[model samples]
Target: MNLYQQAEYWLSAHKIDQLPEDEGIEVAFAGRSNAGKSSAINVITAQRSLARTSKTPGRTQQIIFFKLDESRRLVDLPGYGFAKVPLAVKQHWQKTLERYLQTRRSLRGLILMMDVRHPLTEFDQEMLNWCKLSNMPVHILLTKADKLSRGKGSAALEQVRSELSGEMSVQLFSALKRVGVDEARKRLNEWFQITG
Candidate 1:
Protein backbone atom coordinates (compact mmCIF):
# COMPACT_ATOMS: atom_id res chain seq x y z
CA MET A 1 0.00 0.00 0.00
CA ASN A 2 2.80 2.39 0.77
CA LEU A 3 4.31 2.11 -2.68
CA TYR A 4 1.02 2.63 -4.48
CA GLN A 5 -0.02 5.39 -2.13
CA GLN A 6 3.16 7.19 -3.07
CA ALA A 7 2.04 7.42 -6.69
CA GLU A 8 1.94 11.01 -7.94
CA TYR A 9 1.18 12.38 -11.38
CA TRP A 10 4.42 12.33 -13.32
CA LEU A 11 3.73 13.37 -16.89
CA SER A 12 1.41 13.03 -19.86
CA ALA A 13 2.94 11.94 -23.15
CA HIS A 14 0.94 12.79 -26.23
CA LYS A 15 3.77 11.66 -28.47
CA ILE A 16 6.40 8.97 -28.05
CA ASP A 17 9.18 11.49 -27.63
CA GLN A 18 7.33 13.17 -24.76
CA LEU A 19 7.61 10.03 -22.58
CA PRO A 20 9.91 9.83 -19.62
CA GLU A 21 13.43 8.55 -20.08
CA ASP A 22 13.32 4.81 -20.74
CA GLU A 23 15.04 3.55 -17.61
CA GLY A 24 12.99 2.47 -14.60
CA ILE A 25 10.43 -0.33 -14.80
CA GLU A 26 6.79 0.52 -15.46
CA VAL A 27 3.52 -1.41 -15.70
CA ALA A 28 0.94 -0.08 -18.14
CA PHE A 29 -2.83 -0.22 -17.56
CA ALA A 30 -4.93 -0.53 -20.73
CA GLY A 31 -8.54 -1.20 -21.63
CA ARG A 32 -11.30 -0.39 -24.06
CA SER A 33 -13.12 2.86 -23.49
CA ASN A 34 -15.67 2.67 -20.66
CA ALA A 35 -14.05 -0.47 -19.27
CA GLY A 36 -13.55 1.12 -15.81
CA LYS A 37 -9.82 1.55 -16.32
CA SER A 38 -9.61 4.72 -14.19
CA SER A 39 -11.70 3.26 -11.38
CA ALA A 40 -9.50 0.20 -11.13
CA ILE A 41 -6.31 2.29 -11.00
CA ASN A 42 -7.73 4.55 -8.29
CA VAL A 43 -8.81 1.52 -6.27
CA ILE A 44 -5.51 -0.33 -6.65
CA THR A 45 -3.53 2.76 -5.67
CA ALA A 46 -5.99 3.59 -2.87
CA GLN A 47 -6.45 7.01 -4.39
CA ARG A 48 -9.87 8.43 -5.18
CA SER A 49 -8.85 10.38 -8.26
CA LEU A 50 -5.43 9.17 -9.24
CA ALA A 51 -6.42 8.12 -12.74
CA ARG A 52 -9.33 10.50 -13.34
CA THR A 53 -12.65 8.68 -13.78
CA SER A 54 -15.35 10.13 -15.97
CA LYS A 55 -18.94 9.45 -16.97
CA THR A 56 -17.98 10.33 -20.52
CA PRO A 57 -15.88 7.69 -22.19
CA GLY A 58 -12.44 8.29 -23.73
CA ARG A 59 -11.50 11.29 -21.59
CA THR A 60 -7.94 10.02 -21.19
CA GLN A 61 -6.48 10.96 -24.53
CA GLN A 62 -2.82 10.47 -23.71
CA ILE A 63 -0.48 8.23 -21.82
CA ILE A 64 -0.38 9.44 -18.19
CA PHE A 65 2.36 8.26 -15.87
CA PHE A 66 2.09 7.96 -12.08
CA LYS A 67 5.41 7.71 -10.37
CA LEU A 68 5.60 5.24 -7.48
CA ASP A 69 9.20 6.06 -6.72
CA GLU A 70 12.42 6.80 -8.59
CA SER A 71 12.57 3.30 -10.13
CA ARG A 72 8.89 2.42 -10.47
CA ARG A 73 5.88 3.86 -12.31
CA LEU A 74 2.31 3.06 -13.30
CA VAL A 75 1.22 4.09 -16.80
CA ASP A 76 -2.39 4.84 -17.63
CA LEU A 77 -2.63 4.33 -21.36
CA PRO A 78 -5.22 6.06 -23.50
CA GLY A 79 -8.46 4.09 -23.66
CA TYR A 80 -9.26 2.65 -27.09
CA GLY A 81 -12.47 1.77 -28.91
CA PHE A 82 -15.65 3.85 -28.88
CA ALA A 83 -14.02 7.08 -27.70
CA LYS A 84 -16.21 9.24 -29.96
CA VAL A 85 -13.17 11.10 -31.22
CA PRO A 86 -12.22 12.29 -34.65
CA LEU A 87 -10.55 9.83 -37.03
CA ALA A 88 -7.26 11.73 -37.21
CA VAL A 89 -6.94 11.84 -33.42
CA LYS A 90 -7.69 8.15 -33.14
CA GLN A 91 -5.15 7.38 -35.85
CA HIS A 92 -2.48 9.29 -33.98
CA TRP A 93 -3.18 7.46 -30.75
CA GLN A 94 -3.08 4.10 -32.50
CA LYS A 95 0.29 4.90 -34.00
CA THR A 96 1.62 6.13 -30.67
CA LEU A 97 0.39 3.04 -28.84
CA GLU A 98 1.98 0.69 -31.33
CA ARG A 99 5.33 2.44 -31.16
CA TYR A 100 5.37 2.53 -27.35
CA LEU A 101 4.41 -1.09 -26.89
CA GLN A 102 6.95 -2.28 -29.40
CA THR A 103 9.84 -0.08 -28.27
CA ARG A 104 9.48 0.73 -24.57
CA ARG A 105 12.25 -1.29 -22.96
CA SER A 106 11.33 -0.14 -19.47
CA LEU A 107 7.78 -1.47 -19.74
CA ARG A 108 7.79 -4.61 -17.60
CA GLY A 109 4.20 -5.73 -17.96
CA LEU A 110 0.63 -4.77 -18.74
CA ILE A 111 -2.50 -4.87 -16.60
CA LEU A 112 -5.32 -5.30 -19.08
CA MET A 113 -8.69 -4.15 -17.76
CA MET A 114 -11.94 -5.44 -19.24
CA ASP A 115 -15.51 -4.85 -18.18
CA VAL A 116 -17.02 -7.99 -16.64
CA ARG A 117 -20.09 -7.77 -18.82
CA HIS A 118 -17.87 -7.57 -21.92
CA PRO A 119 -14.86 -9.72 -21.41
CA LEU A 120 -12.99 -9.95 -24.73
CA THR A 121 -13.67 -7.27 -27.27
CA GLU A 122 -11.97 -7.10 -30.68
CA PHE A 123 -9.60 -4.49 -29.34
CA ASP A 124 -8.75 -6.67 -26.35
CA GLN A 125 -7.90 -9.61 -28.60
CA GLU A 126 -5.55 -7.48 -30.64
CA MET A 127 -3.74 -6.47 -27.46
CA LEU A 128 -3.49 -10.07 -26.30
CA ASN A 129 -2.11 -11.16 -29.63
CA TRP A 130 0.39 -8.36 -29.67
CA CYS A 131 1.55 -9.22 -26.17
CA LYS A 132 1.89 -12.87 -27.11
CA LEU A 133 3.98 -12.01 -30.13
CA SER A 134 6.27 -9.73 -28.12
CA ASN A 135 6.45 -12.12 -25.14
CA MET A 136 5.17 -9.39 -22.81
CA PRO A 137 3.62 -10.40 -19.49
CA VAL A 138 -0.05 -9.50 -19.06
CA HIS A 139 -2.58 -9.65 -16.26
CA ILE A 140 -6.26 -9.32 -16.98
CA LEU A 141 -8.64 -7.51 -14.65
CA LEU A 142 -12.32 -8.12 -15.20
CA THR A 143 -13.60 -4.94 -13.64
CA LYS A 144 -17.13 -4.20 -12.33
CA ALA A 145 -17.54 -7.64 -10.79
CA ASP A 146 -19.93 -6.20 -8.21
CA LYS A 147 -22.43 -5.56 -10.95
CA LEU A 148 -23.00 -9.28 -11.28
CA SER A 149 -24.01 -12.00 -8.87
CA ARG A 150 -21.27 -14.14 -7.37
CA GLY A 151 -22.12 -17.10 -9.60
CA LYS A 152 -22.33 -14.96 -12.72
CA GLY A 153 -19.06 -13.28 -12.01
CA SER A 154 -17.34 -16.59 -11.47
CA ALA A 155 -18.81 -17.91 -14.66
CA ALA A 156 -17.52 -14.95 -16.62
CA LEU A 157 -14.07 -15.45 -15.15
CA GLU A 158 -14.08 -19.14 -15.97
CA GLN A 159 -15.17 -18.54 -19.52
CA VAL A 160 -12.39 -16.06 -20.14
CA ARG A 161 -9.86 -18.31 -18.50
CA SER A 162 -10.92 -21.26 -20.58
CA GLU A 163 -10.74 -19.30 -23.82
CA LEU A 164 -7.24 -18.02 -23.14
CA SER A 165 -6.08 -21.17 -21.40
CA GLY A 166 -2.41 -21.27 -20.33
CA GLU A 167 -1.72 -17.76 -21.53
CA MET A 168 -1.93 -15.11 -18.77
CA SER A 169 -3.19 -14.48 -15.24
CA VAL A 170 -6.76 -13.25 -14.74
CA GLN A 171 -9.04 -12.28 -11.86
CA LEU A 172 -12.36 -10.63 -11.11
CA PHE A 173 -12.28 -7.08 -9.79
CA SER A 174 -14.52 -4.22 -8.72
CA ALA A 175 -13.46 -0.75 -7.69
CA LEU A 176 -16.77 -0.02 -6.01
CA LYS A 177 -16.79 -3.24 -3.99
CA ARG A 178 -13.06 -3.31 -3.22
CA VAL A 179 -12.86 -6.76 -4.67
CA GLY A 180 -9.47 -8.23 -5.65
CA VAL A 181 -7.63 -5.04 -4.71
CA ASP A 182 -5.05 -6.95 -2.72
CA GLU A 183 -4.57 -9.54 -5.45
CA ALA A 184 -4.07 -6.81 -8.01
CA ARG A 185 -1.61 -5.03 -5.76
CA LYS A 186 0.30 -8.25 -5.20
CA ARG A 187 0.60 -8.78 -8.94
CA LEU A 188 1.84 -5.23 -9.40
CA ASN A 189 4.41 -5.70 -6.64
CA GLU A 190 5.67 -8.90 -8.20
CA TRP A 191 6.04 -7.26 -11.58
CA PHE A 192 7.75 -4.21 -10.09
CA GLN A 193 10.22 -6.40 -8.28
CA ILE A 194 11.07 -8.21 -11.48
CA THR A 195 13.82 -6.66 -13.62
CA GLY A 196 11.82 -7.27 -16.83
Candidate 2:
Protein backbone atom coordinates (compact mmCIF):
# COMPACT_ATOMS: atom_id res chain seq x y z
CA MET A 1 0.00 0.00 0.00
CA ASN A 2 1.08 3.60 -0.52
CA LEU A 3 2.50 5.41 2.52
CA TYR A 4 -0.17 8.08 2.61
CA GLN A 5 -2.89 5.46 2.15
CA GLN A 6 -2.54 5.00 5.89
CA ALA A 7 -3.55 8.55 6.72
CA GLU A 8 -6.37 8.72 9.25
CA TYR A 9 -8.43 11.56 10.54
CA TRP A 10 -6.63 12.76 13.65
CA LEU A 11 -8.30 15.80 15.16
CA SER A 12 -9.63 19.25 14.49
CA ALA A 13 -8.32 22.27 16.32
CA HIS A 14 -10.19 25.51 16.42
CA LYS A 15 -7.50 26.87 18.71
CA ILE A 16 -3.81 26.18 18.75
CA ASP A 17 -4.09 24.61 22.18
CA GLN A 18 -6.47 22.01 20.82
CA LEU A 19 -3.89 20.61 18.41
CA PRO A 20 -1.96 17.41 18.96
CA GLU A 21 1.24 17.21 20.99
CA ASP A 22 4.08 19.26 19.55
CA GLU A 23 6.59 16.44 19.17
CA GLY A 24 5.75 15.15 15.69
CA ILE A 25 6.62 16.42 12.23
CA GLU A 26 3.75 18.53 10.92
CA VAL A 27 3.40 19.90 7.41
CA ALA A 28 0.59 22.36 6.78
CA PHE A 29 -1.55 23.13 3.76
CA ALA A 30 -2.62 26.75 3.34
CA GLY A 31 -4.43 28.59 0.60
CA ARG A 32 -7.06 31.10 -0.30
CA SER A 33 -10.61 29.75 -0.33
CA ASN A 34 -11.48 27.87 -3.52
CA ALA A 35 -7.83 27.30 -4.40
CA GLY A 36 -8.28 23.49 -4.62
CA LYS A 37 -6.57 22.90 -1.27
CA SER A 38 -8.85 20.03 -0.29
CA SER A 39 -8.61 18.48 -3.71
CA ALA A 40 -4.85 18.58 -3.57
CA ILE A 41 -4.82 16.96 -0.15
CA ASN A 42 -7.13 14.18 -1.24
CA VAL A 43 -5.00 13.55 -4.30
CA ILE A 44 -1.75 13.62 -2.37
CA THR A 45 -3.04 11.10 0.13
CA ALA A 46 -4.43 8.96 -2.68
CA GLN A 47 -7.76 8.98 -0.92
CA ARG A 48 -10.67 10.56 -2.66
CA SER A 49 -12.41 11.96 0.42
CA LEU A 50 -9.52 12.43 2.80
CA ALA A 51 -9.75 16.21 3.01
CA ARG A 52 -13.43 16.77 2.32
CA THR A 53 -13.60 18.60 -0.99
CA SER A 54 -16.65 20.80 -1.33
CA LYS A 55 -18.60 22.70 -3.94
CA THR A 56 -18.79 25.53 -1.44
CA PRO A 57 -15.67 27.39 -0.39
CA GLY A 58 -14.71 27.95 3.24
CA ARG A 59 -15.89 24.49 4.30
CA THR A 60 -12.75 23.88 6.28
CA GLN A 61 -13.27 25.96 9.38
CA GLN A 62 -10.61 24.60 11.66
CA ILE A 63 -7.09 23.18 11.71
CA ILE A 64 -7.76 19.57 10.69
CA PHE A 65 -5.06 16.97 11.17
CA PHE A 66 -4.37 13.69 9.40
CA LYS A 67 -1.96 11.46 11.25
CA LEU A 68 0.31 9.57 8.90
CA ASP A 69 2.06 7.90 11.81
CA GLU A 70 2.96 8.51 15.41
CA SER A 71 5.61 11.04 14.36
CA ARG A 72 4.25 12.55 11.17
CA ARG A 73 1.10 14.48 10.21
CA LEU A 74 -0.48 16.65 7.56
CA VAL A 75 -2.48 19.70 8.55
CA ASP A 76 -5.34 21.29 6.68
CA LEU A 77 -5.45 24.93 7.63
CA PRO A 78 -8.70 26.86 7.46
CA GLY A 79 -9.16 28.36 4.03
CA TYR A 80 -8.88 32.14 3.97
CA GLY A 81 -10.48 35.10 2.18
CA PHE A 82 -13.93 33.61 1.65
CA ALA A 83 -16.08 36.70 1.66
CA LYS A 84 -19.27 34.85 2.46
CA VAL A 85 -18.00 33.65 5.81
CA PRO A 86 -18.75 35.88 8.77
CA LEU A 87 -16.13 38.45 9.67
CA ALA A 88 -15.98 37.23 13.25
CA VAL A 89 -15.28 33.65 12.20
CA LYS A 90 -12.67 34.73 9.71
CA GLN A 91 -10.92 36.87 12.32
CA HIS A 92 -10.89 33.98 14.77
CA TRP A 93 -9.30 31.62 12.28
CA GLN A 94 -6.78 34.27 11.30
CA LYS A 95 -5.58 34.62 14.88
CA THR A 96 -5.46 30.86 15.29
CA LEU A 97 -3.46 30.40 12.10
CA GLU A 98 -1.03 33.15 13.05
CA ARG A 99 -0.45 31.69 16.49
CA TYR A 100 -0.07 28.14 15.21
CA LEU A 101 2.41 29.05 12.49
CA GLN A 102 4.45 31.27 14.79
CA THR A 103 4.56 28.87 17.72
CA ARG A 104 4.21 25.29 16.47
CA ARG A 105 7.57 23.70 17.17
CA SER A 106 7.18 20.62 14.99
CA LEU A 107 5.97 22.40 11.89
CA ARG A 108 8.71 21.78 9.35
CA GLY A 109 7.21 23.08 6.12
CA LEU A 110 4.11 24.31 4.31
CA ILE A 111 2.40 23.16 1.11
CA LEU A 112 0.66 26.17 -0.27
CA MET A 113 -1.97 25.86 -2.98
CA MET A 114 -3.03 28.46 -5.49
CA ASP A 115 -5.44 28.13 -8.40
CA VAL A 116 -3.50 27.95 -11.63
CA ARG A 117 -5.46 30.75 -13.24
CA HIS A 118 -5.19 32.95 -10.15
CA PRO A 119 -1.80 32.40 -8.61
CA LEU A 120 -0.63 34.64 -5.77
CA THR A 121 -3.57 36.67 -4.71
CA GLU A 122 -3.13 39.30 -1.99
CA PHE A 123 -3.73 36.80 0.78
CA ASP A 124 -1.23 34.40 -0.80
CA GLN A 125 1.44 37.10 -0.82
CA GLU A 126 0.75 37.80 2.84
CA MET A 127 1.22 34.14 3.68
CA LEU A 128 4.43 33.96 1.62
CA ASN A 129 5.82 36.97 3.45
CA TRP A 130 4.98 35.54 6.86
CA CYS A 131 6.48 32.13 6.07
CA LYS A 132 9.61 33.79 4.75
CA LEU A 133 10.04 35.78 7.96
CA SER A 134 9.73 32.63 10.03
CA ASN A 135 12.29 30.85 7.83
CA MET A 136 9.84 28.08 6.94
CA PRO A 137 10.29 26.14 3.73
CA VAL A 138 7.29 26.32 1.39
CA HIS A 139 6.38 24.41 -1.76
CA ILE A 140 3.52 25.82 -3.77
CA LEU A 141 1.13 23.95 -6.04
CA LEU A 142 -0.51 25.80 -8.86
CA THR A 143 -3.57 23.62 -8.72
CA LYS A 144 -6.34 22.92 -11.23
CA ALA A 145 -3.82 22.87 -14.04
CA ASP A 146 -6.25 20.70 -15.94
CA LYS A 147 -8.39 23.80 -16.30
CA LEU A 148 -5.87 25.24 -18.72
CA SER A 149 -4.20 24.04 -21.87
CA ARG A 150 -0.72 22.51 -21.58
CA GLY A 151 1.01 25.61 -22.95
CA LYS A 152 -1.00 27.89 -20.70
CA GLY A 153 -0.28 25.74 -17.67
CA SER A 154 3.47 25.87 -18.26
CA ALA A 155 3.32 29.60 -18.77
CA ALA A 156 1.44 30.00 -15.55
CA LEU A 157 3.97 27.90 -13.69
CA GLU A 158 6.88 29.94 -15.06
CA GLN A 159 5.21 33.21 -14.15
CA VAL A 160 4.67 32.16 -10.55
CA ARG A 161 8.13 30.64 -10.35
CA SER A 162 9.68 33.96 -11.28
CA GLU A 163 7.92 35.72 -8.40
CA LEU A 164 9.04 33.44 -5.59
CA SER A 165 12.12 33.96 -3.41
CA GLY A 166 14.91 31.41 -3.31
CA GLU A 167 13.69 29.33 -0.40
CA MET A 168 10.21 28.79 -1.84
CA SER A 169 9.34 26.46 -4.74
CA VAL A 170 6.33 26.30 -7.08
CA GLN A 171 5.01 23.76 -9.57
CA LEU A 172 2.13 23.17 -11.92
CA PHE A 173 -0.31 20.60 -10.50
CA SER A 174 -3.63 19.09 -11.45
CA ALA A 175 -5.10 16.67 -8.97
CA LEU A 176 -7.53 15.66 -11.67
CA LYS A 177 -4.73 14.76 -14.04
CA ARG A 178 -2.25 13.57 -11.40
CA VAL A 179 0.18 16.18 -12.64
CA GLY A 180 3.19 16.87 -10.41
CA VAL A 181 2.00 14.45 -7.71
CA ASP A 182 5.39 12.80 -7.46
CA GLU A 183 7.16 16.13 -7.22
CA ALA A 184 4.92 17.28 -4.42
CA ARG A 185 5.36 13.97 -2.62
CA LYS A 186 9.13 14.30 -2.84
CA ARG A 187 9.00 17.66 -1.12
CA LEU A 188 6.70 16.31 1.58
CA ASN A 189 9.03 13.38 2.18
CA GLU A 190 11.95 15.77 2.62
CA TRP A 191 10.07 17.68 5.31
CA PHE A 192 8.97 14.49 7.05
CA GLN A 193 12.41 12.87 6.80
CA ILE A 194 10.97 9.83 5.07
CA THR A 195 13.50 7.79 3.07
CA GLY A 196 13.77 4.46 1.32
Candidate 3:
Protein backbone atom coordinates (compact mmCIF):
# COMPACT_ATOMS: atom_id res chain seq x y z
CA MET A 1 0.00 0.00 0.00
CA ASN A 2 1.05 3.61 -0.49
CA LEU A 3 2.57 5.04 2.66
CA TYR A 4 -0.02 7.82 2.96
CA GLN A 5 -2.98 5.52 2.24
CA GLN A 6 -2.96 4.50 5.88
CA ALA A 7 -3.27 8.04 7.20
CA GLU A 8 -5.93 8.77 9.79
CA TYR A 9 -7.00 11.57 12.07
CA TRP A 10 -4.86 12.14 15.11
CA LEU A 11 -5.40 15.28 17.15
CA SER A 12 -5.06 19.02 16.86
CA ALA A 13 -3.51 21.00 19.69
CA HIS A 14 -3.99 24.65 20.59
CA LYS A 15 -1.30 24.26 23.20
CA ILE A 16 1.65 21.98 23.86
CA ASP A 17 0.11 20.23 26.84
CA GLN A 18 -3.00 19.50 24.85
CA LEU A 19 -0.97 17.43 22.35
CA PRO A 20 -1.47 13.71 22.46
CA GLU A 21 1.03 11.48 24.17
CA ASP A 22 4.28 11.25 22.23
CA GLU A 23 3.91 7.65 21.16
CA GLY A 24 4.70 8.12 17.45
CA ILE A 25 7.06 10.05 15.21
CA GLU A 26 5.95 13.41 13.82
CA VAL A 27 6.76 15.32 10.64
CA ALA A 28 5.67 18.95 10.65
CA PHE A 29 4.79 21.03 7.56
CA ALA A 30 5.18 24.81 7.69
CA GLY A 31 5.69 27.77 5.42
CA ARG A 32 4.89 31.44 4.94
CA SER A 33 1.32 32.57 4.46
CA ASN A 34 0.03 31.84 0.93
CA ALA A 35 2.92 29.49 0.25
CA GLY A 36 0.68 26.48 -0.53
CA LYS A 37 1.53 24.37 2.48
CA SER A 38 -2.03 23.14 2.88
CA SER A 39 -2.37 22.27 -0.78
CA ALA A 40 0.85 20.30 -0.68
CA ILE A 41 -0.32 18.30 2.34
CA ASN A 42 -3.64 17.53 0.71
CA VAL A 43 -1.87 16.39 -2.41
CA ILE A 44 0.49 14.09 -0.57
CA THR A 45 -2.29 12.47 1.46
CA ALA A 46 -4.60 12.02 -1.53
CA GLN A 47 -7.30 13.47 0.66
CA ARG A 48 -8.68 16.69 -0.75
CA SER A 49 -9.85 18.05 2.60
CA LEU A 50 -7.27 16.63 4.92
CA ALA A 51 -5.63 20.00 5.18
CA ARG A 52 -7.81 23.01 4.58
CA THR A 53 -6.78 25.26 1.70
CA SER A 54 -7.61 28.96 1.53
CA LYS A 55 -7.31 31.68 -1.04
CA THR A 56 -6.64 33.91 1.91
CA PRO A 57 -3.14 33.79 3.26
CA GLY A 58 -2.44 32.84 6.84
CA ARG A 59 -5.74 31.14 7.49
CA THR A 60 -4.22 28.39 9.64
CA GLN A 61 -3.83 29.49 13.25
CA GLN A 62 -3.22 26.27 15.04
CA ILE A 63 -0.87 23.26 15.04
CA ILE A 64 -3.09 20.71 13.37
CA PHE A 65 -2.19 17.01 13.42
CA PHE A 66 -3.06 14.15 11.05
CA LYS A 67 -1.91 10.69 11.87
CA LEU A 68 -0.29 8.60 9.14
CA ASP A 69 -0.76 5.05 10.22
CA GLU A 70 0.06 4.18 13.83
CA SER A 71 3.73 5.11 13.91
CA ARG A 72 3.77 8.48 12.19
CA ARG A 73 1.90 11.79 12.26
CA LEU A 74 1.80 14.77 9.92
CA VAL A 75 1.72 18.17 11.60
CA ASP A 76 0.41 21.38 10.07
CA LEU A 77 1.80 24.33 11.91
CA PRO A 78 0.34 27.80 11.40
CA GLY A 79 1.86 29.73 8.53
CA TYR A 80 4.23 32.47 9.57
CA GLY A 81 5.15 35.92 8.17
CA PHE A 82 1.68 37.27 7.47
CA ALA A 83 2.09 41.00 7.97
CA LYS A 84 -1.57 42.05 7.71
CA VAL A 85 -2.64 39.83 10.57
CA PRO A 86 -3.17 41.60 13.87
CA LEU A 87 0.02 42.16 15.83
CA ALA A 88 -1.37 40.34 18.85
CA VAL A 89 -2.25 37.28 16.80
CA LYS A 90 1.10 37.16 15.03
CA GLN A 91 2.88 37.41 18.34
CA HIS A 92 0.80 34.59 19.72
CA TRP A 93 1.61 32.31 16.77
CA GLN A 94 5.27 33.18 17.08
CA LYS A 95 5.30 32.30 20.73
CA THR A 96 3.36 29.10 20.19
CA LEU A 97 5.58 27.96 17.32
CA GLU A 98 8.72 28.83 19.21
CA ARG A 99 7.65 26.85 22.21
CA TYR A 100 6.70 23.83 20.17
CA LEU A 101 9.89 23.76 18.14
CA GLN A 102 11.97 24.22 21.24
CA THR A 103 10.29 21.44 23.19
CA ARG A 104 8.46 18.89 21.05
CA ARG A 105 10.66 15.82 21.30
CA SER A 106 8.44 13.61 19.21
CA LEU A 107 9.12 15.79 16.19
CA ARG A 108 11.08 13.59 13.78
CA GLY A 109 11.42 16.06 10.96
CA LEU A 110 9.93 19.07 9.19
CA ILE A 111 8.52 19.60 5.69
CA LEU A 112 9.35 23.24 5.03
CA MET A 113 7.13 24.20 2.11
CA MET A 114 8.06 27.13 -0.12
CA ASP A 115 6.66 28.71 -3.25
CA VAL A 116 8.73 27.72 -6.26
CA ARG A 117 8.74 31.30 -7.48
CA HIS A 118 9.73 32.71 -4.10
CA PRO A 119 11.54 29.89 -2.41
CA LEU A 120 12.45 31.27 0.99
CA THR A 121 11.42 34.43 2.82
CA GLU A 122 12.62 36.05 6.02
CA PHE A 123 9.96 34.16 7.96
CA ASP A 124 11.01 30.96 6.24
CA GLN A 125 14.55 31.60 7.34
CA GLU A 126 13.36 32.19 10.90
CA MET A 127 11.61 28.84 10.93
CA LEU A 128 14.68 27.19 9.48
CA ASN A 129 16.76 28.84 12.15
CA TRP A 130 14.68 27.27 14.85
CA CYS A 131 15.02 23.90 13.18
CA LYS A 132 18.76 24.35 12.95
CA LEU A 133 19.10 25.40 16.56
CA SER A 134 17.15 22.36 17.70
CA ASN A 135 19.05 20.03 15.38
CA MET A 136 15.89 18.73 13.73
CA PRO A 137 15.94 17.32 10.20
CA VAL A 138 14.06 19.27 7.52
CA HIS A 139 12.98 18.62 3.94
CA ILE A 140 11.91 21.47 1.69
CA LEU A 141 9.10 21.07 -0.84
CA LEU A 142 9.06 23.78 -3.50
CA THR A 143 5.34 24.10 -4.17
CA LYS A 144 3.69 25.48 -7.31
CA ALA A 145 6.38 24.21 -9.59
CA ASP A 146 3.94 23.87 -12.49
CA LYS A 147 3.65 27.63 -12.56
CA LEU A 148 7.21 27.84 -13.77
CA SER A 149 8.74 26.66 -16.99
CA ARG A 150 10.83 23.50 -16.99
CA GLY A 151 14.07 25.47 -17.19
CA LYS A 152 12.93 27.96 -14.57
CA GLY A 153 11.90 25.25 -12.16
CA SER A 154 15.25 23.50 -12.40
CA ALA A 155 17.15 26.74 -11.82
CA ALA A 156 14.93 27.70 -8.92
CA LEU A 157 15.36 24.31 -7.30
CA GLU A 158 19.12 24.59 -7.53
CA GLN A 159 19.08 28.17 -6.26
CA VAL A 160 17.24 27.20 -3.08
CA ARG A 161 19.40 24.16 -2.40
CA SER A 162 22.60 26.13 -2.67
CA GLU A 163 21.43 29.22 -0.78
CA LEU A 164 20.00 27.37 2.21
CA SER A 165 22.61 25.95 4.55
CA GLY A 166 21.13 23.20 6.69
CA GLU A 167 20.78 19.45 7.06
CA MET A 168 17.56 19.45 5.09
CA SER A 169 16.54 17.65 1.92
CA VAL A 170 14.64 19.50 -0.84
CA GLN A 171 12.27 18.68 -3.71
CA LEU A 172 10.25 20.57 -6.32
CA PHE A 173 6.47 20.01 -6.37
CA SER A 174 3.26 21.07 -8.09
CA ALA A 175 0.04 19.95 -6.51
CA LEU A 176 -1.89 21.28 -9.48
CA LYS A 177 -0.27 18.81 -11.88
CA ARG A 178 0.65 16.27 -9.21
CA VAL A 179 4.29 16.55 -10.12
CA GLY A 180 6.68 15.15 -7.55
CA VAL A 181 3.80 13.83 -5.47
CA ASP A 182 5.10 10.29 -5.35
CA GLU A 183 8.66 11.42 -4.75
CA ALA A 184 7.60 13.60 -1.84
CA ARG A 185 5.55 10.81 -0.32
CA LYS A 186 8.41 8.36 -0.69
CA ARG A 187 10.84 10.78 0.89
CA LEU A 188 8.55 11.46 3.86
CA ASN A 189 8.02 7.78 4.47
CA GLU A 190 11.74 7.14 4.25
CA TRP A 191 12.47 9.98 6.62
CA PHE A 192 9.99 8.68 9.16
CA GLN A 193 10.79 5.01 8.48
CA ILE A 194 7.13 4.29 7.87
CA THR A 195 6.30 0.97 6.20
CA GLY A 196 3.13 -1.00 5.68
Model 3: number of backbone collisions: 0
lDDT of 1 by residue, 99-152 (tens): 999999999999999999988999999998888888898899999999999999
Ranking by TM-score: 2, 1, 3
Please report, as a residue range, the 10-residue window in candidate 2 with the lowest summed lDDT.
1-10
lDDT of residue 65 for candidate 1? 95
* lDDT of candidate 3 at residue 122, scale 0 to 100: 82
Q: For candidate 3, write residues 1-196 as lDDT tens digits.
A: 5667656766778877787777668888888888888888888989888888899998787888888776778888888889899999888888888888777778888899999998777877887777778788888999999899999999989988886666777889998999998878877877788564
Best by TM-score: 2
Clashes by residue pair, model 3: none
Of candidates 3 and 2, the better by lDDT? 2
| Each candidate: RMSD | 2.0, 0.9, 1.6
Better of 1 and 3 by TM-score: 1
* Candidate 2 lDDT, 1-196, residue by residue in tens: 6667788899998887798899979999999987888888898899999898887999898899999989999999888899998888888988998999999999999999999998889999999998888899999999999999999999998998888885799998999899999899999988999896
* Whole-model alpha-carbon lDDT for candidate 3: 0.84
Looking at candidate 3, what is the lDDT of residue 193? 84
Residue 170 lDDT in model 1? 94
